[model samples]
Target: MAQDFDIRGATVFSGLTPDDFTALAQVGRRESYLPGETVFSGNLRAQSFFVIADGGVEVLRREPDGSQTILARMGRGAAFGEAALLDGHPRRALGIAKGSTTCWVLDARGLARLRAEQPVVATRLVANLARGMAVRLVRASTRATQVVDQRRAANSSLGAGEARRSLMDRLFGR
Candidate 1:
């Protein structure tokens, strides 16, 4: 099944040679998920990294109120769960299939094997993961700043309304 999907086109596998990609692909197990099915959940032990081969997936974070906020929508060729693959930490978000999705899963054991046997490919993968993560962080920070600015503008408008109300009250004694 993995052989049917090409890993060479993925950004993380960009620098790898054809043979290296074949070896890496060999380590992956392909799985399909039905619509609305969970690919993985938050706070669970991270077992594997995933590359979307077909359909779509949503990455979501559960709020304290139990509502889930979507963090990202992934399409074909997108790679996710790299941080967990590296550190073996608990998952920070939930992954759900938006449709009938196909994914190539590479667990920690497979990553270790690839690192040992194809060090060059592993290095490129790691670099790509880091680059992807950094871009996400920057985008998040920018969004945070935008939210703060919006709130400030709203508060200023509210303050102006209050000031107008105070002046009207003073003049009319209401």
Candidate 2:
């Protein structure tokens, strides 16, 4: 199963050559999590980057009222906590396993060591993170547009129905 989940497929390793991928696979450690497990929580120091090999994880944030809002849901082949390794910042969100999940987690220290020893790998990983961020932005924009469009259509139809009802009431003296 480990061999089947090629690290090259992960966004953090995108565009890397086969040799670079081999080097990364050598350095990363894979682990499995049971359902409802907390992969990491918001404001906590980030320890590693993960690429999901199977199942789902939820990225959530806590509101001021203490309610959790789901920021995103990621499934197989998705990567998370990647920027933490690059910037050494505490995680901004919590990641919880939605089900039994398999993930390849590359520790921050290991990634730093790899970056120092193999700069090209680092460069490729950076590119991959950028691409992933762009994709997320695009998806958010699309969803917002769809919501706006649906609201406008519903409002328009409601206005038209109201106008027709007013006309009928005036004509019938009701």
Candidate 3:
């Protein structure tokens, strides 16, 4: 049954060493969600971090007008809700399975258990998680800056299309 669980394709775990990967596999479990299923909702207590093994998920932000904006679309190998595992916090956005999706889910409580039983593995997991969070923060900050710049440019004499293209080029490495 454990052999069926695969983390090799996941970016978050791909960088892990043999022992680190083994430790992760011991605690992680593969879970599936159907189309339109709410994996977790904004403001709810985040229970687990997920790494997409197959399919996609969307992180959504709800505005005051009750309209939702896609904050991000997570594809295969992408990780989400990882920050919640490290720090106890409510979810910042809604994560919805875009379709029938397979994900490797790691429960925070499971990690706590592993920490008690295997301190070394716990240490590796913590370090890996920290690095992942740091990388994510950097990416998010860069994207946020681009968004602000795009809006600023659009409001100026610069046309929306040109502003958007310039922002995309700056963000996407053209």
Alpha-carbon runs more than 4 Å astray in model 3: 15-19, 43-45, 142-174
Give candidate 3's error at residue 49 in angstroms: 0.8
Rank list by TM-score? 1, 3, 2
lDDT of 2 by residue, 1-174 (tens): 258775556665656887777777767778888999888775443657888898889988888999999999999988887667667786878888999988888877777777887888877777787788778789988997786667667666777766445432555788
User: Quick one: RMSD of model 1?
Assistant: 8.7
The per-prediction CA RMSD against the true structure, in angstroms, equals 8.7, 9.7, 6.9
What TM-scores do the predictions have?
Answer: 0.74, 0.70, 0.73
Assess the local accuracy of residue 17 in candidate 1 as a C-alpha lDDT between 0 and 100. 70
Question: On a 0 to 1 TM-score scale, where does candidate 1 land against the true structure?
Answer: 0.74
- lDDT score at residue 113, model 1, on the 0-100 scale: 90
Candidate 3 clash pair list: none
> What does candidate 1's lDDT look like per residue over 23-106, in tens digits?
777676888899998898864425688888888889898899999899999999998888888888868788999999988888
Summarize candidate 3's per-residue lDDT along 1-174 as a digit string, tens digits: 155655575656555567766676777788888998887875443668888887899989888999999999988888877778878776768888998988887878878877987788788767777888898889999998887786676756665665555555666878
In candidate 2, position 143 carries an lDDT of 90
- Could you tell me the TM-score of candidate 3? 0.73
